[model samples]
Target: MVRYSVLASGSTGNAILIQTDTTSILVDAGLSGKQIEKAMHEIGVSADCLDGIVITHEHQDHVKGAGILSRRYKIPVFCNQKTWDGMEHIVGEIKTGYQEIFCTGDRMEIGNLALESFAISHDAKDPVGYCVFAGNTKISVATDMGYVNAKMKQRIIDSDALIIEANHDVEMLRIGPYPWHLKQRILSDHGHLSNETAAEILTEVITANTQCVHLAHLSAENNMPVLAHMTVKTILEQEQFKVGQEFDLEITYPDKPTKLRSVRRR
Candidate 1:
């Protein structure tokens, strides 16, 4: 079995602690080492117990503190060659040469777990999301996506747990205070997923074994927790899916750290 928790999830920073029977991996260390340590401590895990750090992209919100955390903890950083090239200047060189490079379709073994990276519709050089397997359970982390493609949909199907993006509400963003260019970037094909778009995709991929739905990367100014949750809940309900029973839904935060989530296995 595998145990996991979202130490924090949002635009400010993001990090998830994934632990199997023998291995522990931190996915995206956007926060400082001290902040990550505090979050880990709250979840009853120590920083020294971490085995690796998996990066999704080279964006500042996803890799801001990646270098500091990897250096301080002496943990390996896994990402694609293009992603590495884009982030090398930001994260500097990995001292131990543990910077494992992998492509979108490549699969790697980390302790008892198997991880596969898949391409996502994002503006980065080689932005990708992850699907990890521990024992018989599968967990997918796919935030920062502009839209869901056919390949992405296939990758997320049958996932035991999913952490997808519900970045903004279209109405809220259209009338929000952001500049025109920023708004354009956000609504572009390479931008984040809107609430309606995420729900539509979930209807196509969600299964009976899908135990949890973690809504991540919400826009602080353009989105509200109540609206995001209500929009998703209503859509699922319309499809005859019951919340907290058939599936669980949650909205992740932007400013404060969230509790470590548990990934239940079948």
Candidate 2:
């Protein structure tokens, strides 16, 4: 069986736990080590047991705690070479043997999990998402993308579970307190995905194997969990899709870890 938990998500920090009986991994370690450890322990996961910390990009909110975790646990950190170059200064210093680099689109064999990287549109050095295969279960974690492209849709489809970014509500973002420049950045093609776009992506990519979908990387100031959920729900309904009957939809929060979502192997 394979299971996942959103330890934390938002602009403040982002981390997710993907685990099977034999392996345990975190997609990003954006939070401080203390915060991540507490969250993991609250959810009954031991930080010391983590096999690797896999990074999606070099953004501070995605790599803040990576160096601390790696240095403390002596766990391997896997990411693209460009990401290593961009995040090296922020993460400070990592143990020589623990820094692992792989090409953006290659299959990374880490313990019992096979992680395949796929490109995404984001304002970072070579951002990518990952599809993890654990036995018969496939779970894809793709966030921080501005828009869904043909390649992204291809990689996201036919998954057992998924974590897609629903970063902001357009109206709130437009009228919010952010400056014009920041607003423009968030709305750019290389910015985060809005609720509507996320729904549209789901409508195209969801398949028979998709059992659970997690809405992640939400904006605290520009979006609310209920609003994000309703927005996606409304769009999905318009497409004649039943939200609860067809599949389970969940929201990831900035303040706490989500309940463990386990994928039942068929």
Candidate 3:
């Protein structure tokens, strides 16, 4: 079985800790180096235990502390060439050996897990989501997506666990304090997913095999924890799906880490 935690999830910063019996991977280090390390320590896992740091894109909220964590721990950083090129300047210098570049849709083995990167619609050079395979169990992490297309949908189906973005409430964002141009960017195809869209996608992809779902990357200004959770819960229940009984539903934080979560194998 695989265990995971959303170290922090929101527009502010994002990170996730993925662990198996033998391998430990930190998905993204959007927070400061000390902050990421502190989050890991709070979860009872030392930063030294991490085998690698996998990046999703070049966005500051996704790679701010990536370079620091890698430099401090001598851990390898995995990202596509395009993403690496975009983030190189921001992350500062990293040794060539510690830079592991892979293609957008390529699958690579890291320690005790097989991780596959899939393209996502986001406002970045080459943003992607991750699918991690631990033995027969699968854990998928997908956030910062604009909208889910057919290919993206196919990539996320039939997972034991899922961490997906439920960014903002459409109405809230539309009427909120953000400027018109900013709202337009968020509502565009290359923007972010609203709570309803995230619910619709989750409802479509959730199979009987899926054990849990974590709603991530929420907009603190336009989204509330209760609203995001209830929106998805209501939609799923409307489809005759039992929210908690069938599979656990969770919310991630922008400032703090979520509790460790794992799926029970069938």
Write down the lDDT of every candidate, Cα atoms only. Answer: 0.86, 0.92, 0.91
Tens digit per residue, CA lDDT, model 3, 1-266: 78888999887899999998799998988999999988988888899988999999999999999998899889999999999999999899988799999999999999989999999988999999999998878899989888999888898898899999999999999999999999999999889999999999998899999999999999988999999999999999998889999899999998888887766456
Report the Cα lDDT for residue 167, model 3. Answer: 93
Residue ranges of candidate 3 with Cα displaced over 4 Å: none
Between candidates 1 and 2, name the one with more favorable lDDT.
Answer: 2
Which candidate gets the maximum lDDT versus the true structure?
2
Displacement of the residue 51 alpha carbon in candidate 1, Å: 0.9
TM-score of each: 0.96, 0.98, 0.98
User: Model 2 segments beyond 4 Å from truth?
Assistant: none
State which candidate, 2 or 3, has the greater lDDT. 2
Superposition TM-score, candidate 3 onto the true structure: 0.98
**Residues 209-231, candidate 1, lDDT per residue (tens digit)?**
89888888888888999999999
